[model samples]
Target: MKKIIQNFGTIVLIFLSSFLFSQNTNSSFEIKNSSFLLNGKPFTIYSGEMHYPRVPQEYWKHRLQMMKAMGLNTVATYVFWNYHEESPGKWNFSGEKDLKKFIKTAQEVGLYVIIRPGPYVCAEWEFGGYPWWLQKNKNLEIRTDNKAFLDECEKYITQLTKQIVPLQIDHGGPIIMVQAENEFGSYVEQRKEISLEQHRKYSYKIKDMLLKHGITVPLFTSDSSFYFVGGSIKGALPTANGENNVDVLKKSVDEYHGGKGPYMVAEYYPGWLDHWAEPFVKVSTEDVVKQSEIYIKNGVSFNYYMIHGGTNFAFTSGANYDKNSDIQPDLTSYDYDAPISEAGWATPKYNALRNIFQKLNNNQLPEVSKPVKVISIPEFKITKTASLFDVIEGKKSIVNNQPVTFEDLNIGSGYILYRRIFEKDEKGKLEIKGLRDYATIYINKDFVGELNRINKKYDLDIEIKKGDQLDILVENMGRINYGSEINHNLKGIISPVKINESEISRNWQMFPLPFDEFLKHNFKTKNIPENVPVIQEAEFILDETGDTFLDTRNFGKGIVFINGKNLGRYWKVGPQQTLFVPGVWLKKGKNVIQIFEQLNSNETVKTIDHPILDQLNK
Candidate 1:
């Protein structure tokens, strides 16, 4: 009996030892001139760019595992400054925006992490990742040698380092390389003095800051493969932002530093984003796969722009360009036609790449998980019981001296309204100082003119003929995405009123559309307004829960929500006619549906099953 008891204790000890061995006790990657030494040998990192904030929290693990199975040695992600720290001096690193879990998950799946911690990460994101609040002070210039901007940058970097420094390669984790300001080369020449100074100072300051926070990993700054006059071209690893065909990229990279080390396609375009009226732009998946294969075959490292393009939830979606033409804002659905679509479903591109990867690696890959099933919600009715303004009435308004900008009102990323009374024959050259995107001007009840912010000038001669009130309403289409144009994202009424080109600035009433208003308003529709605004609400019951689209054909422009998870903002003037609804955000019992249509019409919302890509023209 004594012998048997001793044998049993020994067996338990053996099992415990094996468990410890299976877990990653100590792992590291070494970065030499142009190569990564993973676990002691030279390695080429085939990576893909996917942001944690963009993808849902539930899908992070599955997406990372999928990336590993696709012959990717690393997962590249952007730690968007605006995402982690929404309010200034506040920070959140969990849930869909969990930066640490995302990194650990990559390590768990046997893949390295390449972190892009940009005070200015231009992932076609709103204000290029800089928080919109910074735009409040019109005099504050970002990415410059401005003391205030640098101070804020230091604070954000210090806080972020606390979360990630420990997970880097030198610390027995998967993060091999960290990128500085993203695509800085593209903006350097344009801003010349300010750009070069900020670039140099940011590089030196951030390195010191990280080192102070105990982050000892090697760092690189991604550029446009061009040598700058005074920038830290030597300190950074030479990389191309989006140039795909290796020959063009190689020539440019080689020319930068006499052709020394490993080549990296920092951003390889997989799919383009959609605008209000444009159809879904689908890239040839075959071509992308072929190009990737070519890059690997040629011994080059490339990261897909987005391996799993996710959603831009709420007003986080950004505008692309204002190049003297159409002012195009990106749609909420960030489904970049990537390997994994926005709804966490893998596409043919994912399968094709997985199969190719298997062929190259002798079938050494993890099991592929089944795709999440699509859900459909039956028609629901949401009566618009009260307008937003009616709910918040009688409360003392936060009146401003001038028509305050969204930033001035301490508001970021949403719709804003400016209402004022103009007596008859009050004529002036109405000028808006810094209108972000689109605005609807109304004299009495008739629409006067539409201002396009991309053009950068709004001068409409107004003669208040009848009533004693003029309503100047503006919708912040979106903040600018790329270039030095980021500083111009002051939403709402930026210089609201005007008098013959001279500013009519004083005693203006600004209305901030806070998120709370969605819940505070009494939503009973018995006493509806004669002229109903575009948006309305509805209710429905469902035995089974699933994903679907709340078709907006009957209504005009607005947003829809189910169970209060903002599906996304929708505009009736489309190509993208429907908004995506995730089944998990739905209920198995009764559900509440609300719509805020832009045009004046009353119609119950009808939801139909749809994919993220197929929502165009439907």
Candidate 2:
């Protein structure tokens, strides 16, 4: 009797083992008439979106594990062309920018991969993910079939595919799908001059280029219903975005694919993106759950736009403007109010989604990984200060007749100073032309007023003395990320400065502040004059290093640096009061913190374990 009982248990274990093996080894991926087929069996793709560059490289595996633990079988990501190729000839595929490593880690963490390699990925990124140098080509009409733009696109695709082709499902890897041109329909709608026919040809060319460079996975295009006509390729599977109605999505994709359907909502917004001065967005969890239930029950595949919204670290955040031309600049913290918070804590939505996904499988999901440790740094004071004026004092000035733009000066990111002396005692409407973003005005070291492109402040009245020096410090808040403004988005003083009727174009002392070079040269820390842009630094010792949020509540608008690595920008505004500091960038013994404060200095900094992303300015 004992032997019979043991034999029965052994047989039951073997049967379950065989079933799990079959599930793990399914390789062939196909887009069938009704649904996706894995090894000839219907498979439902449950995906979540998280960019590799946004999450620190060290935290990549943990985040992927979190995705899988939440019952997500697939991870969707975007490859920003600008992130890999900073300059035209220069390339960076190392460290956090390693595309191959990011993909392999996803596979290792038990998740299928879907990549969107966009030469233009409008992810609220700078220039919509196009390299800034692309604008330098005067003859090239971007997002079109022009030779210059096409050539660059081909080169980027060819180089990137070399790393991706080997990972496709056909090659026994986890990659199941690759996205073709990202939302061409949306671009065509924005720029009316560029016709649908032109973009259609461009989309076809891009699709062919992807195949020529060695992409074997099934290709898909994502756009809304109105854009499907112009944004889709004939051969690629059609997918909808931002559509909440599951029935509507099925109908639209069915029509696009000739009545047969494998529906997918490529970008379902779980939380809204926040811009400066606007209230922080907190999406309704009940609404998300309701829509998700509908998608699953009706055999629809959908991916959360951002399952884990990471930090934008550095000045990589972008801005937006609508037809009204009201510019809305994005905040640095991208804590998109996702189920997995910015610091990696699991929100209530995560548990809710997990419950829904678990109902589909008989076996329990993988256990959730423990949260990454967080440490709080004691408040520290900025001991040393140096004015920006003192740093650029001896740097060579480009004596240009007209104010040169950032692209014109060949400085990709940062601030530029435009100086002009009042030749004679005259006061009129002091104005600037082509104000790219934000600027601070000064008269002979005295603060004048501010010039903001978002509010469209063109000029201000001023009273001047004969020798009163005019200084305009312009900061590139961020480029206009989407819509019709791409072609005209250049930072710094773009055109000649004018005082009422007279255009001041001669001997305009234009100084491109080289903080790196100047800081290395001298940049002595001492007693600097107040009310000027100052460079301040402080150091704190950490016994252990983990993810922490830097509190910038007391300080004014400026950038934050952690141990020489840019942590991104901070403003006194309410929405984003803290900057995420990845533990990978900190050291155990000591860590250096620096700030280039443009306004009043608090001379103090603090670190909190959690993020404060939703608070509006009080």
Candidate 3:
């Protein structure tokens, strides 16, 4: 009789799952009695977050496979708008930007997919993943009820959905759930520029847009428990973002879900993101294990916010602002101190969680894959160096009657030089009205001083002759990725120059130094002056191709390029000192290295096996 009853129970469970899975036509996912029913069976989703744009194309398969071996059934990713469409109407989905290939890879890896398609993904990315061109639309208000902003979002979603809708489970692919605009609750609460009604309209409008764009999968909104009021959709599931005391999490979702179940922590943060000067964030593995136990015991579904955080690479990093000081630019290496290291090595946390998850899965999890090879390159010497002034001899500059912004000139990333010949001999506190970030001030090609927006320093006392040239070389540190500050982020010298109380508002020669173009220009190699920008080049040989970190501790501030591909920013200022160089991007024989040093020189650079992401300013 006991045997018969046991068999009957198994059959009943299967029946329940099949019943729920078929009930919803739009989505096979359903909520029933505090459980997620998939194809008539209770399903617990164990997921991880990793961005495709963050990891190199060659490593996507490895990373997704690692996720499955670590006991994850699903992988969640955010489709960054700016990453796919850098400029207006310019769309790129091939190669690394191929969203379809990434999703297909996850499916091939035997894992489910949860896509967070954000017009605003706020992953500490430049301008919260909104393209720099969006700022050009003067009247467009982001994250609110604005026609221009919504119009662009609509067009973007339409373009993006073409990649997603084809891969949904109903269409015989792996994608199971889709997220509406990311964490709108936090934004609505923090932004005072928009009204509660306007914010509410904006949030729902995004959900509507997602539906309009043909995303047929289950839609959900993610925010902390306290933010459910502003972040949730009417018929869609509401999932919490950070910790919510299990009881609160279940209660919040139940209230919003018509007293249903299938409670999910959509973004369970295991570790934290490290900014440029901040301490390396390391969450205890033991604590994470404990939380996993609670979720399993309570019959909850959860996804690690970032099971793996790859490199930010290039100018993709973003800045954070506060009411007190200036912006805090994020580090290029987004290690996130996760279970899997940025270099794709299995960490202690990975082993610890694997043990727990294996037990939960009835010991069905696979063994963790071997890590990618990491090689240490011997120090390589510099081959050539060129002066910035000499390199820009023939480059044209916009002769503006008044100082303009990066967006006005369609210059996205890199540096901008604003030159002005002093009309007459004058000396006062020199100030740039809207210095976007950092500036290196020079008097007649002589380095005089430096100003940094991060320090909130704008003015410097200076004396100039009538014929003396005043040059302000400014770098667009990065744009704000979060909160109300995102609305005001504009690069370069945004406004007029000021001398104490007097304003200098005429005859500014603005030069856009897009480093991408510099590689094509013939640099007149010569002796460079001290404390000014210089382009340095070198060649290094490798017997085998593999992953490595280029140590930049010896160098000051600049960008690194290996074989003409950018490895991203490196500053002596602490937190991140090494940039990851993917093995796939290197040739076994010879590789060219380029460095645009805005500060001092380093005779040679060493490619080390380990990354130094915790170093502070020396």
User: TM-score for every candidate vs. truth?
Assistant: 0.88, 0.94, 0.94
**lDDT per residue as tens, model 2, 468-552:** 8888888887777777777677788777677886887777888885243224324575665566777777788889998889988
- Model 1: weakest 10-residue lDDT segment is 526-535
Q: Please give, for residues 498-535, the per-residue lDDT of candidate 3 as tens digits.
A: 88778886788988886763444465556667887888
Give the residue spans of candidate 2 off by over 4 A: 1-26, 323-325, 514-518, 521-527
TM-score of 3: 0.94
Candidate 2 Cα lDDT to native: 0.82
Off by over 4 Å in 1: 1-22, 137-139, 193-198, 227-233, 251-259, 427-433, 443-450, 454-467, 499-506, 516-519, 524-535, 612-618
Q: State which candidate has the highest lDDT.
A: 3
Order of models, best TM-score first:
2, 3, 1
Alpha-carbon local distance difference test for all models: 0.70, 0.82, 0.84
Alpha-carbon RMSD of each model = 5.7, 3.7, 5.2
Error of 3 at 215 (Å): 1.5
RMSD of 2: 3.7
